[model samples]
Target chain A: MYELTKVIKDYHRGREVVHALAGVDLDITDGEWLAIQGPTGHGKSTLLQMLGGLDRPTSGSVVLEGKDLAGLRESEITAIRANAIGFIFQTFNLIPTLSAQENVEAALVPLGVSTADRRAMAASALEGVGLGDRLRHLPSQLSGGQQQRVAIARALVKEPMVLLADEPTGNLDEETRDDLMALLEDLWRELRLTMVIVTHDSAVARRAQRIAVMRAGKLAIKQDTRPAPAA
Target chain B: MFATYLRRELRRRSRQVVLIALGLALGVGLVITVTAASTGVKNAQAAVLHSLYGVGTDITVTQAPAAGTGGPGGFGFGLNRGTRTRPAPGTKFTSDRLNPGQLAPLADSAVTKIARLNGVAAATGSLTLTDVSISGTIPSFGGSAGASGGSASGGTPGSGGRGFITPNVFGVAGVNLTQGAIGPLSSGKITAGRTFTSADASANVAVVDANYAAQHKLKVGSTVAIGGSTGKSTSFTVIGLVSTASGSGSDVYIPLLRAQQLSGLTGKVNTIYVAAASATEIGGVSKQISTVLPKATVTTASSLAGQVTGSLASAASLANSLGRWLAIAVLVAAFALAVLLTISAVSRRVREFGTLKALGWRSRRVVGQVMGESLLVGLIGGIVGIGLGLVGASLVNAFTQPLTAAVGPTTGSATPGGSRVFGGAGQFGGSPGAGPGSAFRRLASSQTVTVHLTADVTATVIIAAVLLAILGGLIAGGFGSWRAARLRPAAALAKIA
Candidate 1:
């Protein structure tokens, strides 16, 4: 469902140019899970942003389902992001003022879902992430692992075609990290979602079907786990 | 979801919201107080002008008295007749005469001519007169009759055998019975009996002012003998008693034709009061009248307003200058404060906006959320400000002292012209106590009338004040929303905290 060819992204810090993504080429089939592992300041997050249509590549084309995302207008990219791609940040990034249910409902807001239907879907999604009893609790009241679960529920509530997570378990304890990974794997298989996760933890990266390691703005190596297909 | 998010956000920043609202309230309250005070000052000035320049009269036309025409028209006691000999000492004599002070008479036909002019709604002529009566015993000058030179002065008995001269003086106005709505008597309210009718045009009847009637113990139906320039006293019946609002009307009101005949200025009037068809036409009408009668001094209400002086005028200046500027400064400061605080609040919510954008909410949606929060705060401020304004207006009315206004030179004198007898023997020169100096001094001399200032807070003013507050809020909110709309999701989320 995704293709990348010579994706090169650059950033200017005052006068110096830093290359974020350099001549990268990759592809993934529909409903496949891919993980990118890299050191800090490498191209992992930059590549994820490009795939999610959050940012454009400086010199390359990113094709998702036969449409070139790099060439689309900003508004068109926003529409695609709303209808197809869901994002999960390392910090959970839930609106601090809103409750868990309201945060989950925010994902469907741009989809023009009615308030009543949005609330029902948000509740069901939160329940699917084992957070049905915490719908009314604010982000400040929830633990780190619970907040991550609410973020996951928010991402999947709109039933998007792709789920992109950037270090989702980076802030959680080891046990909570394992539990979050297990929940993500289960959702990926059950919904057949094409998932791409950017992470530094080797243990978390090992759960995906394939792992791509990036170094110094280049994809240096790729290792396939060859996991069984979903039943 | 929008409502929920906005409600929670405002609740989170409730303290800042209250602070901004209070700032707007203080500004709006000052605006209302200053505006009300200005209106009150204007009302007081109008009342004073109405008192001096008859009600409904927009312009007054008068001519400066020619060379030496305004003095006492001779007492006609045969002082100037060479055929009559001096009277014997202690011989009782009485004389009374009515003369027009300081203003030259305009022909009565001028009123008709002016009334026919374009934009002239109505015109009526009036004769403002001074009635003077002298009654005393002629003194013996060194056991001989006093030398006569058109001067007759007497007082308490002294080394020169002087005798007392008692003088009674009062103001009289001849009002046109045909057009009573545009002259001096128009401002009076009849308290007893009735004013003049068309039948009284040639009748020897008069309307006495209430204060003058009260002082002289003269009521309706009392006989008052008024002397004419013909050297004959005409007994006129008091037909009515009228009271003026500013206590500034003539002591007696007589028919126009009778006053003209009695004053011996037949077919003439000293002042012409004119009303224009519309207020907007006053300047044009004044110009027209000036063109019609070039020698006539035409005074409009606006020009007369400039001549008003005293505490009321001071109040008007204060309300217009210092009060207005202070209100504007406070309102501007309030709006600036609100804008700064709103921007600061939006800056703190950068992460939340970034996350909303990532969730596929349009930039306008996020901006709209910020605007909604600010507009609600502004609405609260407007309501609170209105309440504060009402309280402030009431306090002004409660604590303010009654203001005084003095209308100057254009409307004759506040002090009536009268005969003054010197304390010497054989002094007999007429005191021409009416001229530009006397007329200006008399009218310019402060006729202090205590006017109770009222802050007229109308519904329109309140509505405008509220709208002003709301506009302040919209401006502040617009700045905040602009900041919010410019946030890029990628850059915003990069700053984790």
Candidate 2:
């Protein structure tokens, strides 16, 4: 679960202060697929960063699983990121020097995972994404779709409770984008992860159980596509 | 994980690592070679200077003859109290010589007083004589009895017109105990037979120099006639032969009492060799010797070691000075190059490190990664440097001659507290053999002695070089670590998308 209260993020571009997320208030439920959709410079990525604990809000609180990230130490926040949440970027940010399997294993490095367990887990995660045969292939050698699959494998290897993705299909062809989206949808369905994706694609927003439309650094609307269960 | 990361990074950047390591190795090699050579010179100087005074002798006290009274005699040698002073300059004694007086103020009593001084562990006297004549014809000088004084043109063969034995035959008195009983001519300096003994004092026994005996065809146990400046000649048996080729080639040696009686200069000595209670007391003993005899010039081992030898001294000095500067320049350049390379490599990897940080690597961990990589480079560089240094040192040793010039002989009155006042005199008279227009007075001799210098790489130098290599790496690594620690993961990871 995640909650943001009156969050304001200001950026300094030379002399002027630009408000990226001004007085934003939102909530995310556990195991829900939520999509934040907006045009460029509308704080879609900023909100995702706050939810993932990758960046702090300039003011106010970002709470995940009832823990206020603002009150946590930097190291504690990192442990939360490493153990409880995973991030996937639009460009599929894999270290160019490492192979697909190694990129997946990297997420577990900070957890002090044993090499044998990390290797076995990494191999299983890649196979789950249908990349078992391409484990040793570097990101440069992989197709856009395959690279995104590797990114998906890396994000899921830690078995985090939440997955934050910023423009997951923004850089791929339409066909590859559809395939990556299907893979992400399958992973979310299979793992029951609380998936938060920031994207402008209408097709991507259509798959989310809830869609929050952002405008002018604020969440202008929230559309519920799926009915809530007992809770 | 850190080790894995470091190994991967190093493997990916092997080229850059090798380049920086080579530069550092070159710098370290030059430092080693230059330092080694300097040490070699110091070692050679120590050996030669110790041998200058005689075995175990630390100081020499010589009464400097007043300038202008004596010409810097043949062989580029400084004149000692070789001959008795005449009443007037250039006034040849119609008789063979005049009675000795005034000049040699050092006496047996002075030796006793010096021995009593603090820090004076042992003191001994040696008498140097010149211009005495030998009756036998030395065949090398055309086999003429008076040939020693002939022309004053030629000295020993191959002497290059210098270091000629003076016209008057030269004789030495008293065992030069300044070097202790081991004798100045230790080892094989005494080539044949045995040295003189106390029993030989009244006996007409002499130990001739190797060169002098060779020229005159004199052998051990052969009797030869020797005449002093006093116009009195005696027949002495040649008991031994020693080499004076590397030193002032004084021709003969006799007992102190015998040489004193022969020269008519009694109760006086020309040179005194003093041994300090400890090496630390040499300076004190030197000061005391000056106090006892103000006119005396004291030369210590250290002071004499400071005197540079020939053109090679300049060469060694140039190597010492220029080598140091060159090494420093190379080290600075290498450091700059290594730093630049490390910075470039680190800057290029900002996004990768940021990603790691975002994945929960602490700033210290990032810094450790950078430092670890650089330290690996440094270790390799140090190993390479050691190899290069050894090769460089060996090459220098191959091309350069390890030799130091032996410090030439010093002459003065030495009286180890005893009754023997070692004294001798030379001819102050002119003879037909004295040659035309040449001063009949005996001349001092000079010869060049060479001592070997062996360049050695000391353990201390090796350790220092290794440490320097590591420091160089750490310095370069520090710069990289600083840059790495300053990287913000949010800003850096944002750069990727």
Candidate achieving the largest TM-score: 1
Tens digits of per-residue lDDT, candidate 2, B1-497, equal 66776787788888999999999899988888888877877665555554444655677666634532232122211121234321222222221222221124357667677778899878766655543332221123332222233334332322321323333344454444333343334322678988866667677788887877888899999876655444546788998997742443346777666666666556666666677899889898889888988877677777665553643465468668998899999988988898899999999988788777766667787888888888888778877888888888788678876454633232222221111111222212122222221333233321234655556888898899888888888988999999999887777776533
Q: Which ten residues in a row have the lowest lDDT in candidate 1 chain B?
A: B417-426
Best model per DockQ: 1
lDDT per residue for candidate 1 within A63-174, as digits (tens), equals 9999999899878888898889998999999998899999999999999999999999999999999999999999999999999999999999999999999999989999
Top candidate, metric lDDT: 1
**Which consecutive 10 residues in model 2 chain B have the weakest lDDT in total?**
B415-424
lDDT of 1 by residue, B1-497 (tens): 87888888888999999999988988888888889888888888887777777788998888765543444444434343333466766776666777675567789889998999889999999988767666667676644333322333222222233435565667789989888888999878899999999999899999998988999999999978787875557998999999875557678999988999888888999789999999998999899889989988888888878877778889999999999999899899989999999999989988888888878888889889988888888888888888888898898799989888765533332221111111111123233432333221222244556688888777877898889888988999899999999887777776531
Superpose all Cα atoms of candidate 2 onto the true structure and report the RMSD in Å to 1 decimal: 7.5
Residue B363 CA error for candidate 1 (Å)?
Answer: 1.5
Off by over 4 Å in 2: A213-216, A229-231, B53-58, B66-294, B401-447, B451-454
DockQ of predicted model 2: 0.45
TM-score of each: 0.90, 0.77
TM-score of chain A of each: 0.97, 0.97
* Candidates' C-alpha lDDT: 0.81, 0.69
In angstroms, the error of model 2 at B10 is: 2.5
The local lDDT score (0 to 100) that residue A42 gets in candidate 2 is 80
